[model samples]
Target: MSTASRIAIVTGGSRGIGRAVASRLAAAGQDVAVVYASNDKEADAAVGEIEAAGARGIALQADVADEAAVTAAFDTVERRLGPVDVVINAAGVMALQPTRELDLAELDRQLRTNVRGTFVMAKEAARRIRPGGAIVAFSTSITRLRFPTFGAYAATKGAVEALVPILAKELGGRDVTVNAVAPGPTATELFFDGKTQQDIDRIAAMNPMNRLGTPQDIAEVVAFLAGPGRWVNGQVVFANGGAA
Candidate 1:
């Protein structure tokens, strides 16, 4: 990698794991453009953290599932930050319901953002990412754990995992890597949303680390995949701290 600062696009970057990844990339001297769904305040705060890390930062709002909006966001990044060197497709949504009683509307929402949004991001990345660049998408440890009530969420990510290697092979000889990070029970607002303290503790104890994964914990993996972890490509990394 050149000493010339690279640019990174982190979706869902207004909060949670995405925000942490943006900050980490910035600290490593990469300018980061955070693509958030909504919440102007949070997005601005995320940019502040990135800029405070001594890297350039910008916040752009877009619905990840909308192709036109996503495309426009990509154009804006290029116009302001230069060609994209890294894209972290971290935007996603989840609704916990038994597969038997699937909430059709919620399922659609998850599919739109998780599966379709990932595909959209991947498509843009495949077209725009510079050589030696990387495209990192988000998956969930629940996919491996077979958790109940995670059926729709896991389905979307399963598609993402399947897409990883196919896209990598398609981008053959491009010096770009396509990979995903399946994070375990991270301590994010999204994860803590419906669980009780006991539920959280039980899930945490399932892993050898004996605690919930943090946003920073997963951000480290994204930084590696998006930076110098070149030999690793077209694979889904279990960043779950020995969970499952």
Candidate 2:
């Protein structure tokens, strides 16, 4: 493929895997619109990195699930950076609780951010992503492992997994490949947020790699799907190191 620069929208690009993907794409010579829901500072820093990598960087804020906001954010990116050639839907949240005792609010929050947000971004991507463009979404290995407290969280990811293949078919004629990257336990701040060190270690050990995945590991896979992975449509490429 040509090495000409492309434009991309990377949702939740302020930190973690999102940041890594945005930076990687930029390093690969793609102008990146780093979308962040709330953290402008981190978003600005991410954009700076993208620019420093010799690609344009623009920081736009929007809730991935909010229709009007998402539309406007995409519009701004298109206006400033040209039509988006790739979209990485990395904006998501996770909550842990048993099904019976799960907090209704937390469950709704997860559904809104993960399921609805993914659909909203993906539908828009289907509409605007250029031919040969790619759309990458996030799922979770928890969906495979079926751990006790992750039922709700996994359910949302499972929803995305279901959405990907159909969307890939929807975009088949247009050459826009759609896929998801389901990662196993990662060492992001999100993973260790409330866990004890022992808890984190135990979870890391579950992976056959004998260590947790890193944001960069996930980003590398996302980059493949975004650029060179033209033939890999409608697939969920798991990056868990055999944890699941």
Candidate 3:
């Protein structure tokens, strides 16, 4: 892949799906800013991979849920890399708990981080992105599956799916596309932690592919949307491999 002059920002780019998306963009020749919450080490590692792929890379630390921090992060990226040509809102949290046992604080955190943070990043991207740029937000198959303990988390992702069309309309005249990617089960740290072999097997069997999705699996779709698939706007492209 040859690099384009485009610049991209991948929130939560320090690890997992975000990191994969960042690397994909880099492979396509876009300078990438890998944003992380706290760990500069992980962010640096991602940046190194991007540089190795022959694209310029930078690591920025910011809390996606905090408005000021998010604003600063975007501003820094723009200052360093010029106007963002692509924005992938992949920063989110998953909190699992039955409704009766769900703590109010945890519920609030999930909503604030997933829903509000997405909104903040999208709004900022709408304002700052280049005319031909694209924005991709993260949703989850859990929104459709509606698992019992995923009420709050799924609700937040559902809100994101609902926003895609409106955002696409808002950015229409500017030739910017807005979309969301809803991924099913992926073998990320989030899924592996606190899972026994039995739990892992059950989760894997839930997917028709008989295996969990990989971060790269999801990133490939994101790369398409951010590049050639610009015509596909206001859509929630599910990359779950028939899991949902």
Which one is best on lDDT? 1
Candidate 1 residues 103-166, lDDT tens each? 8999999999999999999988899999989999999989999999999999999999999999
Q: Pick the candidate with the highest TM-score.
A: 1
Candidate 3: Cα lDDT at 171: 77
Query: Of models 2 and 3, which has the larger lDDT?
Result: 2
In model 1, residue pairs whose N, Cα or C atoms come closer than 3 Å (at least 3 residues apart or on different chains), thus clashing, are none
Clashes of 2: 0
Q: Candidate 2 has what TM-score?
A: 0.98
Candidates 2 and 3, the one with greater TM-score: 2
Off by over 4 Å in 2: none
Query: Clash pairs of candidate 3?
Result: 3-29
Candidates sorted by lDDT, descending order? 1, 2, 3
Model 3, 11-49: lDDT tens digits are 989999999999999999899999888888899999999
Q: After superposition, how far is residue 133 of candidate 2 from its true place, in Å?
A: 0.4
lDDT of 3: 0.89
The pairs that clash in candidate 2 are none
In angstroms, give how far residue 193 of model 1 lies from its true place.
Answer: 0.3
